[model samples]
Target: MRRVTAIVPALLAALMLVVVPAVNARADLLGGKMTLRDENKMGHDFDQILRAQQNMVGDTYITDYVAEVVARVVTGKRPMPFHVKSAVIANPLINAFAIPGGYIYIFTGLIQSVDTESQLAGVIAHELAHVSQRHVVSRIEKQKKVTLLSTAGMLAGLLLGIAAGGGNAAQAGQALVIGSQGAATAAMLHYSQDDEREADHVGLNSLVAAGYNPEGMPQTFEIMLKNKWYDNSSSMPSYLSTHPGTAERITYLNDRIARMPKEFLERKDDNTRLKRVQALIRSRMSPANTALAYWDDMKQSDYTPMDWVGRGITLERLKRLDEAQTAFEKALSLAKDDPLVVREAGIFYFKSGQADRALGLLQKASIMNKDDAMALFYLARLQAEAKQYGEAARNMRKVNELVPEDWEVHHHLGMILGESGDVFGGNLHLAYAAVYSMRLDKAREYLKRANELAQTQEQKDQVRELEDAIQARAQIGK
Candidate 1:
């Protein structure tokens, strides 16, 4: 096919390499650039491996939230790579992992249990340390000597379990455990305690250097210590289960905090951000819980814009739309021209079927902050629904350019193009739309030409399934 052929073989070859470790002569860990032999061994690219694994784990919201806060704290100070993707898994364990690249995943349970953002920062910083120090690759190298075949076997086993709904495995070839995928994840947890401690120590310094409160380290450790005692298991909470001992580490952190300058102990943020995060969580809670948290924030006697925003969100979620509107408007009144407040109101209006109102508010907010891609995208969605097709397409195109990987936008654009009657161009976009959607029939239709498309076997398999399903649906229609 008239695909990007020059790079396609290497791309396809890369996909095959990482599909499973058995294809490889050596399971070379990620660190430097991939060698041809290493490439041959895995049969797929390492990047694909990481991406597949991330998709397997799903949302890691706590990680994202913590990373956002830390990013704010360390902004302009550290030369950390711009994190391209972040996710928070729904898992309630205390574990966090970062791939060789900038992908970081944090478990929700970890956030629910943490006492402070700094503590969370410590965890994130530690994971960032892993990425920065190339420790994941280092561990991979260390594992190679311990027994490569068994390691690959174990990793493979664990991954199979995860894929089949068995559990989490840190590495590729571990012995497969039956039942919950938790077992495999628990296995990876074993090697990283010392690494975790080192990360905590180093991460604390990183946090302080970045001007976050270093006291968050020891304070969080203390909370973990209490949880440790409260737990009946020999293993620490799932967070610490993978990491090494925390008691000595807590003491060490306390000693460091005691001896260090008093400034680190007294650090704080706008608090609005933290409270907003808390509020966001509360807003998603059950109605009873939402009411409780909202009242807790209000009755606390310490009022803040975030509290108002939080209560508004909870009320909105509770379907008390008018009350929600009032709360958000009050927040706006308190803080005139706040983009966050305006954005929230715009979202409420948009979701409430008031497309014009939502568009008006969002457009004004975007003008106030022209770089708000989300605001622009939402406005575009409303416009599209309202049959303002040309405007919607333009906005969609803009957002697509800004966030090329967002498949939904591409899909929308493709549908618009198809309906607009530029059949060939539309088909080309539709092919991309199918690939992004992992739709088989559409991919097959688009890939009918002898194109050297670089798709992993799994992706190819998904396309085939989609094609079959599409055919079945069409038959039913006929």
Candidate 2:
């Protein structure tokens, strides 16, 4: 099934390439209008495909941290024209990219590569600049001979191929896009040198305006350059390959940074959040052995409570319960008042069969941050384990509120609500969970059950709406 799924995009690319006339030859072809709405539509379509194919990180803490960084870059005293949404990809490749709309994707590798929040923010700002400046739309407009659908198909196929990393898949993707015009395909995949410089300049200003030190922009480029130096050219990151003129870019950014005001170059004092965010990624994203090795290699003097939290998680993943508990205890002792530390300790305790300890810590964490969906979810689980069905359902509902698209949360919430006698609500949530998980048949079954359990006309109407949504998504899958 996975193999078939992988081949489908390549097949589509091939079919489109064969059917559509060469973009360069068709001077008279009516190019699609590059309106904001059209750009958003394209981005939405691409986002769906990418989400289906990629392992997107669904942790609320990590995602929220990234969103907060993007918000600082894109949002200011002036409102943005379009809503920008960001997601973290689970890939270890050090790269980030923006689609046509305000859709930006950052890889875990990129997050791990940066030492500071401002450096991470610089990459985001650069991607956001690409969108805000309408670089993609402008490029599409320039290629007036190409149809939007075909171009989008070709681009998606090529990107998916590169992302998949298998030799055969990459070759198929390259063949589909580079059919008789490798140069043209390359041009389409990347922005011009002029556009790249403009994004750097615009992104630098936004980074400074958002109170990040302008030094972060040049520093980030330096990191990328260093990484590239250590890596073989064939193994070079996609970012470096697609984003040409990196050497020149680094030089330009450094020159710009040198001319910045003294006050603007001064670093911000609040990097605690950045450190915690990085710890979360390292703990959760890295393999257990790798994470343990990393922690082992780091000097003990540099280990903070957050670092202990990461070590605890890695130990837990490795099934070293005693050591994991000790790590968590050390973290709590160091920063007992910190909500994130409390939450991690709670989770570790729960996994170690100390339900009572887990409950207290999780409750404290929840109180500290009402929007902490992970804490709430764990609390709800503990409540259910204690046979407090009503309380469990309530907590699960809150978790659902905080993370509406989390299929697992919805699934657990549905079961809890069902056990608590809210059959209608349970079935509705179950249907939503199935839908989000792409279990269309299961979703249909749950929706039908929800429809039967609907007492109020309003409830029936809601079920009908969900049914319509399921049908629409089904068509898209086809």
- Residues 1-478, model 1: lDDT tens digits: 0001011111111111222332222433433343334422232224334332433221122234465765754452267643424555433334555554455555544565566677777667766665555444444344442223333443355344344432233223233321222332233334366666666666776878877777776666666667777743312354454446777778877787798888768876554455555554445432445454646655535656656766777777678889777877777778657765676678778877777778878888767866555667777777777777788778778767765534456667766655655344345556655554445466568645313342567545644554554453322201
Number of backbone collisions per candidate: 43, 0
Query: Candidate 1 — which residues are off by over 4 angstroms?
Result: 1-95, 107-117, 145-188, 224-237, 285-293, 300-303, 419-478
Tally clashes: model 2.
0
- Indicate the residue-level lDDT of 110 in model 1: 54
lDDT of 1 at 337: 76
Which one wins on lDDT?
Answer: 2
Off by over 4 Å in 2: 1-32, 76-79, 148-165, 173-186, 231-236, 475-478
Question: What's model 1's TM-score?
Answer: 0.67
Please report how far candidate 1 places residue 199 from its true position, in Å: 2.1
RMSD of each: 10.3, 5.1
